[model samples]
Target: MLFQVGGQGTRPTFFEMSAAQQLPSSVRAALTYSLGVFALRRPFIHKILDYEDEFFALLMLVLETHSLRTTDASFSESLYGLRRRGAKIKLKKSNLLTNSADEVRHTGLRKRQKVLSVVFLVVLPYLKSKLQSTYNREREANLQASLWGDSDERFDGDFVTGDNNSFGSRDVSNIEASARDRCIKRVRKIVGACYPWLHAGNEGLSFAYQLLYLLDATGFYSLGLHALGIHVCRATGQELMDTSSRISKIRSRERERLRGSPWLKALQGGLLSCAYAVLDYAQTGLIAAVFFFKMMEWWYQSAEERMSAPTVYPPPPPPPPPKVAKEGIPLPPDRTLCPLCLQKRANPSVMAVSGFVFCYTCVFKYTNQYKRCPVTLMPASVDQIRRLFHDV
Candidate 1:
């Protein structure tokens, strides 16, 4: 009975609802929640974050009530392209007295429906979130108590605490309290067993409603609207944005003409100008904020990927193409002979800058003095005369 189909006019499609309603709501919540998380380390900020839902509810209630009163739509609905109207009630006539047909009324949201819708929009979500949070905490505590054999402490409030003195009084009290204890224990057990099922059932119902809404079988996108006898229809150029703009322009012209204390007028003008500017550019600013957050998210993800990726090193410089004696330098026919020393290499060392080998002492002395390979006459250094051990 709470959820009815078919409105007087065409209902907004699911995509329109998602874009105009769902996306903006999600972005707004995420933006505030992100700010809270960023400043969560500060005690005052953390306390504000703890009551985030309540704060959000109060803020949204004010905004929504204003919007509804003025434009028959919420801020997001007006900003994008949707408006809420009261669902039409159909009256069917019975033919026993006289053959009368059906009638449909075109009345917009009544005062009661408007109030109910606003409460459902702003208050219900906050209450639901609180209930879910409390349930989760209680469930976790119950689980801990069960695991650690601390059930007595957890259930202390569920039972009566009696006096230790007076044995006869205690006996009478025990007899009277036994039934109450059993009833309370049984109820607690039943509730404990039913909580999971209740949660699942709520989720299932929400999903079903969402599916129905998506399929256009429901006149409202959310249960709140449906329960309050409200319908969302595609907004057709009746938004208050244009009216607000015109009013702003008229106020600006009037303010410019009005006479006042020069300094006070200047201050008022500055503040009003800033407020008007914010109103005009709020949508663009929200878009820019979303873009900036997305860019930051991408940057962080890329940085993380770079950190997680494996590093690579260039393959060790290909063993400097097997060192060869210079064409002009005369050398022994045996390639194993050091080109500089002209003897079988001993403590052989190579000049890195040029492809030639010699005894470490010979290369060190020559390069230290001339700073070049003796065989190739190319610039080198004593540091480049790396000594090699005889493998043989």
Candidate 2:
């Protein structure tokens, strides 16, 4: 049922079209995750990476808009030899002379449909991601406030602490305070009541749509497309032209159109045409390259299936340096005594910075006060005190 013949065309398999549709998004996510990993150590780079979703959304908007405008297909759809068409239901007026049947016609999407689809595809995802992030932040804040009872303390402070009579009118102050308290309570109540339902609804809808998509229902590949009555179909033979052939045709048309112009003018137009062709090829090459690299990455990361697959053994560690003989023997430090307390070690702890042993209380107090190792005087903090299981 994925394909039906009104006019003969090579219908793309559901999986092929779906894969092509998801390819760009997959590429975007992979790139974002990779960049985040690489930039983890750089605070500035991490800050820039935070807006990666927005940046990709903008890029998709431009690419999809351009592809849709010129080719009647989004970028992925064009790459996959598919185009978006509006499915219009036409009713034939009952006529006595000849009988006409109601039929569905498919044509390029109108301007309004194109705009709406682009907004859904680009804006909706951006807003959804932002809303999810906001929800997480609010949830974490509320959890912390609940655990520490900070929210209650703040509310009490706001309610009980009124402005001085000398600073403001008593009636005005009470009114302002009451309004603020009510607003805060209302906001908290609304967020608590609605967020759970919103989250559950989003998850349930996504799961249902995915299940439908898996069943290969027509016009259900994308929610936006289904909602807007836009259908993706294979480009027929006459509609699908090779890129090179199209470029040649364009060049011929330009040449004929510019025939009466001066040689210089004609030359300029020719250069521009050549540039456009090159740019188109470059885009195609880039898409192919991305797919190639992604495939290679997947192949390498996947576990070997056959026993004959090559196994790479790491180089063995270098042999330790030969022990050197010394002229004088040095006495080792007393193991039973704490360095700082100078007594039998009790509840011993070690300074992580200096790796020196001391009584836990002694080390904790010293680091808390001096912020340094007692023996080595190296900069440290109370957090560096690590308790040792073994008695010194």
User: Could you give the C-alpha RMSD of every candidate to the true structure, in order shown?
Assistant: 17.2, 13.8
Each model's lDDT comes to 0.66, 0.69
* Cα error, candidate 1, residue 289 (Å): 4.3
Native-referenced Cα lDDT, model 1: 0.66
* Candidate 2 residue-wise lDDT, 260-279, digit = tens: 55987778787877766655
Using lDDT, give the best candidate's number: 2
- Over the stretch 1-392, how does candidate 1's per-residue lDDT look in tens digits? 01122234456656656665564455565566466657856657776676777767776776677666655776567665566778676656465357444343434667887788687777766766766666666678678877886766656773445755645667778787988977866765666566678779867876777789978565557767767767776555444465466566776686888568999889888887776566546546555655666677788899999999988978886665544346535666887887667888888876777756677877787788887777767777787766666522
CA displacement after TM-score superposition, residue 370 of candidate 1 (Å): 74
> Once all C-alphas are superposed, what RMSD does model 2 give against the true structure?
13.8
Pairs clashing within candidate 2: none
Off by over 4 Å in 2: 1-11, 37-44, 91-102, 151-218, 242-392
TM-score of 1: 0.53
